[model samples]
Target chain A: MTSEIIIQAIVTGLMMGLIYALIAAGLSLIFGLMEIVNFAHGEHLMLSMFSSFWLWSLFGLDPLFSIPITILLLAFCGIITHYFLIRYILKAKMLIQICATFGLSIFIRSIAQLLWTPDFRNVDKPLLEGRIEIGSVFIGQPQLYASLVCLVAFFGLYWFVTKTETGLALQATAQDRHAAEILGIPSNKMFAIGWAIGLGCVGVAGGMMANYFFIFTDVGINFALFAFVAVALGGFGSIIGCLYAGIIIGLVESLGGLLIDPSFKLLYVFAIYLLVVIYKPQGLFGRY
Target chain B: MDSRLEFAKSEPIWNTNNRVFSIIAGLIILLFALPLFGMNSFYLHLFIMIFMHAVMAQSWNVIAGFSGQISLGHGAFFGIGAYATSFFYMEYGITPWISIFFGMFVSAIFAVLIGIPMLRLSGHYFAIATLLIGISFQVVFQRWDLVGAASGLWVTMTPEDSWFALQFHSSKVPYYYVFLVFFLITFFLVWLLSRSKLGYRLRAVRDDPQAALSLCINVSNYKIIAYVISAMIMAPMGSLFAQYILIIDPDRVFNIEISIIVLLITVLGGIGNVWGPIIGASILVPISEYSRIYLGGTGGAVDLIFYGLILMIICIFRPNGLISFIPKDILERKKQR
Candidate 1:
């Protein structure tokens, strides 16, 4: 492969990795706040893409402009999921907890299929529809914009969690729920807010992807798998770890696809995940 | 307080008392005699599906229920069983009976190879790792030309019922009886497991690995045992499914949906219980069949949506499963420790 093609692959991988990081960030945030793995997380991304697609198809608003709306819609969904489903399983057994979210995932995906047939849909002509040449390498404008937005969002979330009081309170609750409660922090509300923010990140990433990637009910499964890998690689509760891990996964996926078989790209990623999990069960940045 | 303690110690989940045993025995007898009624193909097919799913759920229960290691990639073992049996029969002209053993052996070996590294991680980590592994198997098998690739393998047709060939083109009744035998075998094995010391140790490992370790239990070894047994049990059923359906494909055999469906059945019936798979399959299979019959096609998702709702509701309200609703008095009887 030519150096230019390799560079192009790297750029593409980096952009895709940013989106993966943002999605993983949401998952990591929720895990940080509470030790629940949302098996339905991929469905949340599916919902976001659908949300953006519908907005564009019905109102003729570009995905770029529909970002805030998708974010709000997904955030609302997160809160609803939290209040209605998550709260009940908070103290359930591990198997039950896993099943609840898993059930929600199937439920959401089926509903999506019911409402919108499984045919792949895409934004016909979004505002950002082309590629930009940077010297000898080229990048899709949609991918570039999506990656930029995701990068900004990742930093923004990092800031909110670290510098803000509410974020600290959320962290406190995650660290020790009873202690945080004693300190007058409503851990319940923090959990709901955590879900909202967590899914909001998915919303942004999904909406951005709707510009280029196909919008479909099952689209989230693959992306969600990547996010899970990123979260596991980066460490479950570390935001920055997701960023680095996401990039690494992206590069590996693209380069592996370029160098080897594109079909086995997922296999390579899974291999890395298995290696990390076997050697460092705690993850590269995991506290537990 | 002493009586309550005794009651608590009683393993009521099995309900091994004479009355319950007689009732269960009668039910099995009835099932065995079902083919005598000359039921139509549809009912027979449903029964066959129920039996097959029950066996699958029971196998899963060996691991997730007893050992508390929820593997989301069980389809890999199932696919191995399917592929191995079908490949041997299709290519080498071997009987499925012999190939079935090959499938089980391969699955057991794969389980150990997978379980050693994966069983170290707990909870979501292990679950997702297995899930990814399952997906990768599908990807690999799809591209593998040796196994017929994406087009899958189709078993040769037979004009008449042939036990040797493990095919019944004339009627579904033979397949029903075949699957019933497998189900009963799996059921008996699980029943035996519940009474075994290995079962207790597995339960110990599941309930408290740290405590199990302190008690000198080989936690990882027990888990691997449970996992291997689970995989072994699952493989034969895959072989049977391939024989019965006369087709084996990567998508059908290796799909993650198979794993999830197995989970739902075991969870719905009752996890960690001998009869959980039976009860779960009895309820779930019918719902799936009827829904497919009536609410299929453009409304295809109705059943799945219903299943999803049922799963969530069960997880939220009846984490112990529908078996919990059988009345504690029936499931539990006063017994001396």
Candidate 2:
């Protein structure tokens, strides 16, 4: 590939990495605090896509403007699932929680499929049509916008965790739930917040991702696998680690296609994951 | 060994409930014979699929159910077994009878490599790690290029030989008998395992690895052994399944759907119980197959919804499986009488 092609590839990959890191960070936070893997995580993203897609198609609202609506809607659904279902199995074995969420995921995916057939849907908004050229490399308006949105959302999260009392409670729960509870942090409410943030991250990511890939019931799986690998590589439940791992994963997917088939990207990701777990069972930045 | 046998005899063969099992067993035999009367290929295919799936779920129950170490990569082993036999037969004209056993051997070795390091992890680590491996195999198989790459590998071997080819064309009856043989073998294997010292150790490890280790059990060894045995059992079943379908594809064989269905069945049927997956496969597979007829094309997700609901209910009410829902005290009373 030429220098221009390489630069463009890197830029595109970096943008993709930021989005993946955000999605994975959401999943990591939920698992970090609540110890639930959220098998329906991808489905939540799918839900947000359907919500945004429908709103835009039906009401002609701008997709970006529907971001808040998607976040609010998915957060409400996430809270309900956590309270009615995941709350009871919080302290149980992983298999049970996995099945519960796994089932929940399929259930929701089925509903999405029922409503939105596996057809590609797109929004041709004027705001998303332009591009910015830096030197010889080019970046599309949507990619740049999505990347900016991801960075903004991430910083907002970082600020909330450090400055806000509730955000502190969420972090504390992840550190030590029992200790947080003893400190009068109301661990349950914090978990609910964690769930909301976890899901809201997915909502925002989905809204942006729909700009790149078409919407479908199973569309979430493509990103979900990447996020799962990123979390495992970055160290489970570590946002910083997810950021590092997500970019690495993105670069691999783009560059690996040059060395081997693009399909091997997943295989390479897992192989690296196995090596990490074997060599550093606690993960790259894992506290556990 | 003698002392262990005496200890086993003192505890009792089964934990009560003779009447119910006998009735259930009788019903199963009748159900197995149901296709004999109908001669309907559709129902026969469905029954055969149920048997193959039951065999797989039962094998998974050995590790996940008895030892509580769930591997999402079991689908990879299933794919390996099927592809190994089909490829060997197609490439070198090797008889399937021999290739099938080799397939199990290959799967067992694979289980050992992955399971040795993985089985030590507790809870979600183990599950997530296994999922990564499953994805790994899928991507690797697709890229190998020797196996037709992403388009998927297919064996055009004719279904001519009855015994050697493991293929039949006359009617679904022969295939039904073949699957029955496969299912019966799996059932016996599980039965023998659950009654043996190895089985007890697996249960102990699953219940609490720490406690099992404290008791001087080689927890890691036993866990790996359980995985190998489970993988071995599943491998041949995959070979049989591949032959039955007369086509072998990575996506079809190694689909995450296989793992999901097996896990759902084990969870639904009452894992660790010998007949749980059979009960699960019998109930769920046919329904899923039938639903696909009505639910396919337009983003059909009905089967997924159904399977997910069953899994959730099981997790909430009876984590030990449906068998746990049975009143233990009543069974104990029946045993006393």
Candidate 3:
């Protein structure tokens, strides 16, 4: 492949990687707060995309303009999910916990299919329509904006987790729930906030992605799988690690596709995940 | 022991009671007699599917339930069995009776290769690894041209009803009986395993790996054995399903939905017991079959929505599963000494 093509692939990979990082951040935030991995996280992304699509299609609101709305909407979804489902299974067995969220995922997907009819819907003629050309390389405006927005949101999440008192309390609860409780950090409230912020991150990524990607009931599965890899690769509970792992995965995906069969791109990504997980079960930056 | 303590034991005591045994024997006889009463093909097909899924779920229980390794990639093994059997029979003109063994053997080998490396990871990590591995198998099979690529392979129909060929186009009755027998054998073997020393060691590994290690149990080795046995049981069901359908496809056989449904059935009935899958399949299969038949089209997803709700509710409220609802008298005939 030409050097120009290689540079182009790198740019595209970086963009996709930003989005993957944002999604995995949400997952990692939740996992860090409690050891539960939200299997419904992909469905949460799907819901955000659908929410964005509806805003654009029905109200003529552009996806870019609806980013905040999607964030708030998904945050509300996170709260509802926490109160309605997560709270009940908080102390359940690992298998039960996994199944509960998995069931919720199936339920959400089924409901989406029933309502949306399973046809692929696109926000046609969105505000971000054209591509930007820089010398010999080209980047789609949607992808570039989506990635930039994801990067900004990811940074914001990092700031919130590190700088804010609420974020510190959330982290404190994650470190040791009983200890945090003894120190006056309401574990339950922190958990609820964690879910909200976690899903809000998904909201930004999903809203931006709806402009470029197809909106469908099943679109979240592959992205969710990738996010899982990113989380595992980065080490669970580490936000910055998600960013690094996401970029690496994106680079591997695009480069693998460029060098080998495109159909086997996921194979290489999964292979890397298996190798990393087998060798370093604690991940790149995991504490445990 | 107090009555509460007696009931607290995870293992049901009804197995040793001749009364419960007679009841179970009577139920089996009734099930066998149903086909003779001229049941329609649709219902016969439904029953066969339930039995097939029961066998699959029971096998899954061996690994996930007793051993506590939740593998979400069981479709890989199921697909391997189907693909291997179909490929051998279709290409070499080998009878499915023989090819079925080949499928089981291949599945066992793949299980060992996968389980040895992946099984060491615990909790969500293992589950995700297996899930990705399963998806990878689907991707490979879809691209591989030797197995007809994405379009899939068709098992040729026999000219007549032939036990040797494992085809019975004339009647669904034979297939039903065949599946029923397979289900019985799988159930009996799992039951026997539950009582064996290996089963105790496997349970120890599941309950606490560290404790198992402290007791000198080869935890990983026991897990691998359970996983391989589960794969062996799951493989033949795939072959039987292929021969019955006379068609095999990567999407149908290797779909994650197959693995999920297997898990749902096992969890719904009971996770850790031999009877769990049988009970789960009996309830879940009928609901799914009836919904697909009646609702039709995308409306069939209605049952799946209900399935999701039921799974969630069960996990939250009755994680012990519906087996816990079995009458106390039927469950325990004698208190522990």
Candidate 4:
């Protein structure tokens, strides 16, 4: 491959990594706190894409402008979903959590098919339509904005998680929910909040994706797998880990796929996953 | 509390009164008599599909229902068996029946490669990893030069040689009998698993890995074993499917739709029950098939929606499954009374 192609691949990978990071950030928080795998998390993202699509169609709203609404709406949805099904598995086995989440995926996908049907929907006007020319290397306009938004979101989340009171409480609860409860941290409610935030990120991602691509029911499964692999690679519950892992995955997907076919990229990722589990296990940034 | 505990601990006492058994027996008898009644080829074809799906569901139940490891990529092994046999038949001129062992072996190898690290993930990641494995394989099969990529490979062997070829042109009877044997074998395996030490170990690990580990259960090894063995069972079914359909495609075999269908079956009949998948497939497939036939081209998402609603209801109220309702009181008696 040419140096230009390599550079472009890295740039594009980094940007895509950011998008994965945004989704993975909230996902990590929920897993860290509640240990409930949001099987419908990707569906939430899928729905958010639909929301953004319709919002743009009806009201001419920019995806950037619709972010807050999507986040809030998804937050509410997450809380409700948790209350209804996930919380029951909060104290249950990992298998229960799996079945429940699998069911959740089913429910959400079905509902999505019902309301929107299976037709692929997208926004026509590109959020990042133009591009930047850097000598022979060119960057898509959307790619630049997506990376920027991702970086900003990550930094903001890191700051808020470490610096703020509730953030600390969230962390403490994740570490030891019973102790947090004994210390009067309101673990249950905080977990509900974490779920909301986790879902909010999925929604945000959905909207962001809508700007660059189309929406469908099955769309969530691919991203959800990315998030799961990212969370696992980054270690179970660490925010910083998810961010880094997402970026690593994004780059590898680009560079590795370029070397081989894109079809073989997952084989590489799964290999990485196995290596990480056997070696680091705690993840590169996993909490001790 | 004892009764509630019993309910939680024991299988629901089989209620002989439930017409579910009679209905099942009646259906089987009807099917058995259908060939004797001079049935047309269309009905025979439908029966073959039901049997194949039932066999699929039963294979899935071993891993998902019993082991509590929700592997969404059961289709991977199924595909492997299909492709392996097809490749062997075309290239080496091996009998598909003999080649099935090779298919199952290769598929099991892939399962092990997947099962080791992935089995550690347990719930969401386990399912996601399995799904990714299927996706990866789908991508591999679609693009790999050897398998003919997305267009897929077709067996060059004609089905006309003899009865020994395991290929038939005029009748669905062979297909139906093959799937019937598949169903019985899978059912027996799951039944045996339910009563065996392996089953106990799997359930223990599933219930609490740390505790299971504390009890000296090698959690990862046991889970990996369950997953790989389950894959071995699926391979032949895949081989059979490819032979019957005479087509092998990545999307057709390794699709997410297969994952959902298996999940829906286990969920509907109630997870962890022996007959759950059989019951679920029987109930859901006809509705799904009819909807597809009736809806024809336009809007066939109704089946998905139906499953979604059923899953939600199942998950929320009857978390144990549909089987729990009929068997609850009996189990309660075993535990509490």
Candidate 5:
């Protein structure tokens, strides 16, 4: 491959990675705090994407304009899901927790199929519709804006978790719920907050993705699998790790597709994941 | 006094075993007699599905339930079985009866390959790795032209019924009996395994791998054994299903939904128990089938919605599973008395 082509692939991979990071950040946070791997994390992203798609299709509202609404709506969804489903199973066995989330994923996907007719929907006439050329490389405007927004959101999340008192409490809760409770942190509330923030990141990804990607009930699953990989690769529960890991996955996917066959791209991604898991089970950036 | 106490303990165990054996024997005889009464083909088909899934779930139970290794990618083994059997039949015109064994062998080998490295990871990591492996198989199979790629492969069925071919013409009866026998054998094998030393080792590893390791138990070896056994058991179902359906597709057999459904059925019934998969399959298959027939095409996923709700509820209320519920309650009542 030419240097220019390689550079383009890298750029594209980086952009895709940002979106993956955004999606995985929530999953990482939730796992860190609750030790529950929400198998339905991708379904929530699917829900958000549909929300964005519906808003666009129904009211002629641009997905760019629907970002805030989608985040708020998904945050509400996260809260409700936690309150109704997750809360009861908080102290359940690992198998039970996995099943509950998995069932919820199936439930959400099936419901979406029922309600939305399983037809693939995409936002027509998105605001960012063109590509921008820089020297020898060209980039889609949607991709650029999506990555920029993701970068902002990721950094914003980092600021919230590390700098603020609420963030410190959230971390403390994740570190030791009992100790945090003793120290005046409402661990339950922190869990709720974690859910909201985690889902809120997926919401952001969904809204941005709604501009370029096809929307369907099962669409989130395709991306969600990658998010899981990113979370695992970055070492679970580290936001910065997810960001870098997502980028690495995206780059690998794009470059692997370019270098090898596109169909074999996932093979390369999985290869990296297995190597990391075998050698570094804690992930590239995980403290554990 | 010690001998008398041992005899007292052994007596109840023997009695309970005899009672369970008799009940199982009675049920088997009833199952064998059902077709003679001229049951409808639809119910027979449902029974076949229940049996097939029960076998598959039991296979899952060997690893996830007994060995405490949660594999989210068992569909890969199922797919391997289906594909291997169908390929042999299609390319070489091998009968599915013999080809099913080939499928089982292939799946067992695949399980070993996967289990060796993956068994090292604990908890959710193993689950995720298996899930990825399942998806990767799907992707590869979908793209590989040798296996019919995305469109899928169809087995040609002769008009003449051939027992050797494992094909029956115009009747679900033979298929039902074949599946019933297979289900019984699988269940019996699992029961025997559970009662054996290996089963105890598996249970010990599951309960506490550290303790098991300290006691000199080869935890990895036992886990791999469970995984291989589970995969081998699951493969034949896929082969039978392919022959029964007369078609095999990567997406159909290799789908993650299949894996999830197997897990749900096993867990829903009572993981690790011989009866768990049977009970779970009996409840789930009929409900899903009925929902599909009644509530399908209504632009709403009523069946899946209900299915999801039931799964959530079951996980919450009876996490040990539906099969364990009545017995536990009965035992409690007896204790109170």
Candidate 6:
């Protein structure tokens, strides 16, 4: 392959990776706080994408303009999911917790199908149309904006979790719920906040992707699989690990698709995931 | 305390073991006689599906419930079994009866290869790895030209009915009886395993691997054994499914939904118990069948929603499964009286 083509692939892969990082950030945060892997997390992204698409189609609002609305909506959804469904099973068996989320995923997907139908929907005349050419390389406007938004969101989340007192409380709750409770952190409320932030990240990703990608009930599964790989590859609860792992996965997927058959791209991603899981279960940056 | 003492002192009206045996015998007799009553093909197909799902769920229970290894890629083994038998039949004109064993052996080998590396990861990591493994298998098979690629492979129909070929010309009765035998064998093996020394070791590993390791139990070995056995049992079911449907596809056999369905059935019934899968399949199959008939094209969505609700409700209200809700007091009272 030519150097230019490789560079192009890397750029495209990096853009895709940023969105994946956004989706996986929520999953990692939730896992860190409650030790519960949200199997239905992908569905939340799907719902947000649909939300963005509808806002664009019905009100002529650009997907870029609907980002804040989608984030808030998804954050509310995260809160409701935690309050009604997840809270009760917090102390249940591992299988129960996993199956509950898996069921929720099915429920959300089916509900979307029932309400909006399964036909692929896209934002018409998105604000970021066309591409920008820089010397020998060109980047799609939608992808560039999406990556920029994702980069900002990632840093914003990192700052919130590390700098703010509320963020420290969330971290403390994740580290030791009993100790945090003794310190008057209100573990339950912290958990709820974690869900909101985590899901809100996915909401941002969904809105951005809605500008460029097709929207459907099952679209989340396609992206969610990658997010799962990214999170697992990055270590379960490490935000920085998730970011780097997401990028690695995206590059592998894009380069593998170019080097090998496109159909085998997913195979390469899974191969890397399996290898990492077997050899480095703690991930590259994870302390545990 | 006084009531408990009095209960212990009471004489039993009947032998509990004998009564249980009689109930099972009566149920088996009923099952056998149903085909003779000229039931419709649709109900027969439904019962066959129930038996198939029950077997699949029970096999999953061995690894997930008994050994504490949550595998989300069991459908890969099932697909292996289906493809093994289908390919054997299509290419060498081998009968499914013999090729079913080939499928089982292949699945067992595959299980060992994957289980060794995968079982090293604990909890959610193992689950996610298995899920990806299952997906990768689907992707490879979809792109593979040897197995007819995405179009899938079909079992050629013989002109005349042949027992050796595992095909029937006229009725679904043969299929039901064949599946009944499959169900019985799987059920019997699970029952026997639950009461055996190996079962105790598996339970020990599942309950606490660290404790099991301290007690000198080879945790990984037992887990691999459970996984291989589960894969072997599931493989035949895939072969049976392919034969029943007369078609096999990467998506149909290797889909993540297949693995999820088995997981759901086992969880709904009560994991680790021998009878749990049967009870779960009995409840779930009918609901799905009826929903499909009543709801038509949107039936899939309705069923998906219904299953999701059931799973959530079960997780919250009855995490031990519906089987646990059975009144122990009633059985005890009948025996004591």
Looking at model 5, residue B294 earns an lDDT score of 86
> Considering only chain A, what is the TM-score of each predicted structure?
0.99, 0.94, 0.99, 0.95, 0.98, 0.98
DockQ of each model vs. true complex: 0.78, 0.59, 0.69, 0.45, 0.67, 0.67
2 against 3, candidate with superior TM-score:
3
**CA-only RMSD, every prediction:** 2.5, 3.0, 2.8, 4.3, 2.9, 3.9
lDDT of 3 by residue, B153-220 (tens): 98887899988778898899999999998888888889878766787778888889998999898888
Ranking by lDDT: 1, 3, 6, 5, 2, 4
Clashing pairs in 1: none
Error of 4 at A47 (Å): 1.8
Say which prediction, candidate 1 or candidate 5, comes out ahead on lDDT.
1
| lDDT of each residue in B122-189, candidate 1, tens digit only | 77887888889889999999999999999999987767788888988888988998899899988888
Worst 10 residues of 2 chain A by lDDT: A255-264
How do these models rank on TM-score, best leading?
Answer: 1, 3, 6, 5, 2, 4
lDDT of 3 by residue, A1-288 (tens): 799999998998999999999999999999999988888889999999999999998899999999999999999999999999889999988888988998999899988888788888899999898999998999999999999989999999999999999888898999999999999998989999999999999999999999989999999988889999999999988888999999999999998888788999889999889888879988898877
Model 4 segments more than 4 A misplaced: A113-121, B1-31, B39-43, B120-125, B157-162, B210-216, B328-337
- Each candidate's fnat, in order? 0.78, 0.66, 0.59, 0.46, 0.67, 0.70
Error of 2 at A98 (Å): 0.9
| Candidate 3 docking class | medium
* Per-model TM-score versus the true fold: 0.97, 0.92, 0.96, 0.89, 0.95, 0.95
Return the TM-score for candidate 2, rounded to 2 decimals. 0.92
Model 1 per-residue lDDT tens digits across residues A2-115: 899899889989999999999999999998888999999999999999999999999999999999999999999999999999999998888888889999999999999999
Candidate 2 per-residue lDDT over residues B58-163, each given as its tens digit: 9889988888887766798888888888888888878778998999999999899988877776666677777767667776777667776676656665646567
Instruction: Indicate the residue-level lDDT of B7 in model 4.
Output: 42
Between candidates 4 and 5, which one is better according to lDDT? 5
For lDDT, candidate 3 versus 6, the one ahead is 3
Best by TM-score: 1
- Residue A180's lDDT within candidate 5 is 98
Looking at model 6, residue A165 earns an lDDT score of 98
Winner by DockQ between candidate 3 and candidate 2: 3
In candidate 6 chain A, where is summed lDDT lowest over 10 consecutive residues? Answer: A278-287
